[model samples]
Target: MDNIDKMVGIRIKTRRKELNLTQKDVYAATGISNGNLSEIERGNVLPSSKALVSLSKLLQTSIDWILTGEASIIDNNSPEISNIEYGLKLNESEELIIFMLRSLPLEEQLDVKNYLRAKVAKYEKSELSSTSNHGKNVMDGNSEIA
Candidate 1:
């Protein structure tokens, strides 16, 4: 197997161990079949991008995190998590979330929680500042999406 395949296998095995889940559970969640998932996790075969996305979701991590161990996709200052891309294609939200987690160190889950809380506070402060500047009338009849 190539590097990518090996990485996939390693990530699958790690997640399975962490979650106390079996290959069967992954198969059921990803609809990949036990034998296939096993082979993929063993680095006996390469998985398609679609299958990788499914596994990422079941594992609750991002494809980028799984494949490259990089959680922040675009690496901007905002905590607005970006989408996870598989090569040129992109994974959905669940897959992206999983991929992001996969990139995180085992000890950093708490860090992520703290980071999210701080970002939420920053957003709330910004909202309050905007509202106060506009006064009561500006917000009274307007129903604008933030």
Candidate 2:
């Protein structure tokens, strides 16, 4: 494979690992065989357009990004999010969430966003406290041992 093909393959492999997906999972989702995926990851062969499209959809990325390492800009005025039913294959629950979010009023959607933000803040605060406490305990334990 050439440099561009190797770069694309690296992007594919990196994105797959980021999603914590195995080759088997990718194969099941994209109908691409495990051997093919392995070869693609190793930069031995370029993937077809169909496979690239399937991977971009499954990985929630753009084909341009996968192929050229350039991030595609999403137009705010465009109905890009709503047009997800085109080639993207989302699970039922994911589809339902998008539907429900789209169905909500602007105010309700803002409220949902605020609620999620607050929940994330609380979780992060708790995690930080736990980590600090663990560090303190380790320090104290070392002092006692010494």
Q: What TM-score against the true fold does each predicted structure earn? A: 0.47, 0.54
lDDT of 1 by residue, 1-146 (tens): 68778887887788767776677666655679888888888878877899977767656677787777666333322233333233334446655664676566534544676788999999999999877866764668654555
lDDT value for candidate 1?
Answer: 0.68
Query: Candidate 2 — which residues are off by over 4 angstroms?
Result: 72-80, 84-146
Off by over 4 Å in 1: 72-146
Tens digits of per-residue lDDT, candidate 2, 87-135, equal 5666677667766764664446557868889999999999999778778
lDDT of 1 at 98: 49
